[model samples]
Target: MGRFLLAIGAPPDRASDMWKRFEESGAMRLAVELEGVQLWSSVDLPLSIEPGGSRMILGQVRSRSLGDDDHPSGILPQHEQWPSWPKLIEAFWGPWLGIEYKHRSLRLELVRSADIEMPCYYALAAGGIYAASDADLLVAAGACTGEIDRAALASALVYPAHRPSSTVLAGITELEPGRRLEWTPGRLRGHALWNPWDFALPPAQIHDLQIAAETVRDAVLIAVRGCSAGQRVILGMSGGLDSSIVAAALRATGAQWSGVTTVSAEPAGDERYYARCVAEHLQVQLAEVPDNIERIDLRQCHAAHLPRPNSRSFSQSADKSMLEIAAASGAKAYLHGGGGDNVFAMLDSVRPVLDRALDTSGWAASQTVCDIARMTGRSVVDVALRAGRLALRHGRDAPRIGNSAFLSQSVLETAEFPHHPWLDTPPGARPGKVLHVNWLIGIQNFLEGHAGQGDLPYRAPLMAQPVIEACLRVPTWMWCTGGRNRAVARLAFEAMLPAQIMTRSAKGTPTSFLYDILEAKRDEAREMLLEGNLASLGCLDRDKVEAALGAVQRLMSGDVLALMRLIDTESWIRARIARQRD
Candidate 1:
């Protein structure tokens, strides 16, 4: 990936002057200001830049493209100068420049995709406007002083699905997903660039199974067309519907493919037999990794990737390692069945409301909020009541993404904030709508941000804008008309995928390796927790942390959710310390 930085508000004539400013501060090169936009480019890793005299620091990083046969170097070329500001802006945004500009005051011209591939962070202080692509670099520019925000920490501890806008530290606000913040002079405005409510399922859009199949096929083709022609694409096939369909999609595109199945020696995690069947059916090479949880190095892992105390012990280190393995094995791009669950409308189970007096008008066909609360030991009644209230408020006949259990507690708490002062609804009214909102948020904020930092390009064919738009137009009954899950997308994909893949039901959850991995590293896990590497940060509950780790040491099987939370907490704590040092 390449890094580009721009500092506006500085005098255009000070080319050499800006150069020295950057050089003295170890910034890669001199800064250039043109047409009210100053810019700099760097190919170095661990990118760092000094504060400029201007209030704007716009950084654009181009990650390795999935397909770039035209560019022999496997990198997207950066034109030294654009013909006009609009062209340069379009280059950064791709297809997003057409969206309405609500937060225009930030005076910053932002044009990233709905999925945030290249993330930008800004902090207004006495020092002027400060922005950076990396959180560490933003801190280095004196934007945030390595402090954690307590509310953000609480949200993280409570929900593992998404990250909130405000971090653990007070003053440092994160740009939420699907949100664009523009700050200029005395005003700052952040607007939701996308809302699932804006997109509706069209009535009787696709009854013809053939039409659905072709649509799915077309979506898959469009998703992979940008990949490097011969790059081996990696699929996380689990013999489940999502990955299986994806595998079939790759085969249809004539793309060379390989599959990785994380198998447990026991029956529980081993989807290998089914996975093998699907792989063979699709004629793709597959590899199996026996992830023995009993012998994993949990403590060492904690020491390396996680330093905070963890109540969850075992984890499959294989998932992390497999990416590098796949890359080394000649795969330049990886595609997974991520976003399949949301697309498929795979409501886990429906709960019958006890309140016979209440009309179903206030609720979606699926009781998502209630189901979620039940699964997580939360108050189901309260969640359901909120959903009912939301349906009544929006006056929209359709079930929105914001009305689900996962959205209110997991997705929104983790990824978004309590903004959007424009509307009024029950606390839980927009359960489905919130999730749809986060779909945009995840694309515009999280996915791209993470990928950019890691120097890898990530694409989700399932979450492609066109695919989402089509699925939204589909009727709920048509969604698996034959009683199949993910009916809409599955039906859409029928022509592109094998019948075996299109009809699969069982799915794999990554948490299956949770307990096994923790047990293997029990001792190391205890040491890391007791050592208090992360306790120095006042934002955590040390007593609770110790107890959690101790409980995890006693587990034999797996608790995937707890395990993920442990890793997330530890990583966050460590990142806080590292950022503080910066």
Candidate 2:
């Protein structure tokens, strides 16, 4: 994996020290100085650097046709025929991020597709701006104070939602996906360069499921071909429709790919049977990594400097084992079906169908209401009443889902959690469009943060730009026909997947392992939360937290999830403190 640190507008002397600090963090293996910016990276990145222009392009690019018509239709020119310098930007596709330099200014841009992840965190320091791919590097360089942002912490603990462009540290900001930040002599401006919603087409414009399926299949194949060409690929097979489809696509391309799955001793948490079925159907070699909860080491479960809220404590060893196996197998990329549910398995809400039908005609609306009634096994009158109620309350704030009762009153009072932007979108907007936008943002944030954590490229073909656009253009009714989620996708891959695998609805839950982990480490967890920085900083009410921890065995699943979040927060804060002391 490649990481970068850039210091712009700093004095020449200060820039040198900043570079040294970055190197000392043990994260950077190479350092280079441009006009007014210093770039440091751990890997010798594939960067097309223009020293004179102070511009650099990191990662590979696939050629795109500009449709000049002077050239062959729909065919990309050879790399030799590509344009040079800034002009090359227009034809650039694939997983790439860029940094452009102007007169006393630096601009950093994350790719539109959010593949080849490069997360940038920035803070003002020493009369200049410093940004790094790692937040810990910025803190080490003295660009940020390292104080936890209480509001952000509260939001994470209480809302289960991450603020779009904010980090846990005060004054340190992360650049959102598909956004650019330009830092001039003494000012910085952030701009959104792409919006997935803009690609969404009205339902009236889409009429064929087969064409949609073909478009999606072609996009996935292209993405897999581009990413896994001439490389050993490993697929994380979950035996679900998403991963099964990806496996089938990889097989269709005649690529060298294998499947790996993590299985648990607990039957409830094990999916090895389903995984085996998919592997057998696809005719791929399968490797199983047994995640025995008894072998989990509590010390190794602690967060390191950075917080990974979505990660589970029991899966760390299994994750490391998978990475090691991939490395040993000479794998260049690991393909998994991330974001498949968000893009394809839309919610089966009646509101969207009702809205679309009403916009068309009364007969259409009544028919839709009847379909919904049949699908939901509710009376037509009841379905229509519920749809009307939903329509009336559209675009209004709903209740937050996370457990905030355990938070300290002071923290709750002072924290400013902004309402989700999607909730305020125009009421007349298609319900599917609104939901798609919400899921896109959440999934993009997740993939950018967690994917590609190790050296091997973790590619999600399902999240490819073309595939997401195609899925969005599909009507909502198709997604959840007959009250089945991801109906379109199921129909699309019916022939490639087994009936059992395609129609399987029961998802494996890791609750048994989670509860076991908590039980095994309950005492340590209690002490950590009670005496850790979270309590010391007044982010949590000690009494309530103690009670909750004491009642873990009796708590519901939702409460357990909330407690896990608290534990993660406490662990992260403790790690930050230890690093600061070091």
Per-residue alpha-carbon lDDT of candidate 2 for residues 299-335, written as tens digits (9 for 90 to 100): 4433353433433455555556667778878877788
Candidate number with greatest lDDT: 2
Model 2 regions lying over 4 Å from their true place: 21-31, 50-54, 62-93, 104-113, 201-205, 294-311, 358-383, 396-402, 419-428, 444-452, 541-544
RMSD per candidate (Å) reads 8.5, 4.4
**Tens digits of per-residue lDDT for model 1, 1-582:** 234443434334443465565567764553444454445545442222223222222322222123443332222233332222333332222122211122233365433333333444556555235444444544544445656554555454443344345545545555532455665666677776543444432232454656765665565554544332346667777777777767776776577778887776557678887788888777778888776654454433332111112222233345454566566787765666667665555543222121111223335333434444544345867656654675457433222222121112332345323332222222332333333333333332222322112434445656654445545444333343454656667766566555766666665554546654555555655555445443443433446545555676454333335444445455556656665664
Question: TM-score for every candidate vs. truth?
Answer: 0.67, 0.86
Model-by-model lDDT, in order? 0.47, 0.64
